[model samples]
Target: MIFAIETAALQTFDGAFADELFLVARILFGGVIAFIGLNHFLNLEEMAGYAEYKGAPAPTLSVGASGVVLVLGGLAVALGAFPTLAAGALAGFLVVATPMMHDFWAVPEDQRQDELNSFLKNVGLLGMTVLLLAVSTVEWPYAVGVGLV
Candidate 1:
């Protein structure tokens, strides 16, 4: 199983169609992440209020900082620039924010399902971040070639 996983992780795409698909996926993924970050700014007051409700320290500052991280990281990923740093920022954000922002178990019964859905969505995104991290050492076929690795 370990070998299979390794093989899969190391697999490379070499065709035009595959390249386009990978590039499109990156753009879509990064676009959505960037949009989500932008949303933090657009909804700052509401998001800060929720953060305060969750007992986050310096809720306003935290939200703004996270928004910057997301915007920068998402753009890097989309542009294929500094993928390792970008992925790290994104993964870090998700790791910390997921539980704090979407703690279904801690929410009231009426909001539990909504929070659970968000938690699950974040988990899926976390999985994608891990995948990007795993491939950060490789030259991305359609990337802008701005990464140190």
Candidate 2:
């Protein structure tokens, strides 16, 4: 009886630890994305200028729209509110933004490495967001939300 009780206790602790890890990962991903999205608003003009430089049409409007998407998508993913929609939006954003903004191969050799790094980073973020879309079948313990897979 004593051994059985001890094993149960150990299992409970392990399960709790795993739950905590999931919570932390969700918080971090959401927080970071929100922060980046906020930055877009905070520096709208500068971001627009940069986007314009990169040949984006209606730079100011486009950048603002993108910012809105980021904020909404980031929050949705983070809060586990609408994981599928959020992940899809974010993934789509990355797909377009990565190639359009981080076209390393199209840039001059001197800028190639930097652009490559940026491209890869965006790709990685896209991958994570897409992954969130893949296993979004969770019923969610409550109304609020939970972490990615």
Candidate 3:
């Protein structure tokens, strides 16, 4: 019985540690999104220029919309409010944007490295988003508050 109790206590500690790590990751990732979103608004012209260079249609409008989504979704994720939905939206956006906006595969070999890095980063982000969605469905702030529970 004592051994069982010790094991259970250890498990609880592990769970708490995992939760803390997850929260820290959520904050860092969300902060990056928020920063980039703010940059979109503050550097609207630069964002539009990048969009146009990427051959995106209606560069200005696209920049604006992406900026808004990033800002709102980032905040939602950071606060652990509606995390699942926010993560889903971000994943979807990355799916589309990675190929359309980044297009690392199409670049020259020398220049491709950076683009590939960006592409891989987006892929990782997508994975995180999906994981966050899964966790949100299983946990309190996300499940109960967001109705995923």
Best by TM-score: 1
Q: What is the lDDT of candidate 2?
A: 0.77
Task: List TM-score per model, in order.
Answer: 0.91, 0.81, 0.80
lDDT tens digits, residue span 1-149, model 3 = 35543432122214556767766777899889888788989999988998999998999999899888888778878777777778887888888888877787888888798888888988898888887776665553222255344
Ranking by lDDT: 1, 3, 2
Q: Once model 2 is optimally superposed onto the true structure by TM-score, how far is the C-alpha of residue 20 displaced, in angstroms?
A: 2.2
Per-residue C-alpha lDDT of model 2 across residues 90-140, encoded as one tens digit per residue: 889889988998899899999999999999999888888866676455543
In order, the Cα lDDT scores of the candidates are 0.90, 0.77, 0.78
- Candidate 3 residues lying further than 4 Å off, grouped into runs, are 1-14, 140-149
Q: Where in model 1 is the C-alpha error above 4 Å?
A: 1-11
- In angstroms, the error of model 2 at 9 is 28
In candidate 2, where is summed lDDT lowest over 10 consecutive residues? 5-14
- The backbone clash count of each candidate, in order, is 0, 0, 0
Residue-level lDDT tens digits of model 1 in 1-149: 35543444555777769878878878888998999999989999999999999988999999999999998888888999999999988999999999999999998999999999999999999998888898888787779898776
lDDT of 3 at 74: 83
Error of 2 at 30 (Å): 1.5
Which one is best on lDDT?
A: 1
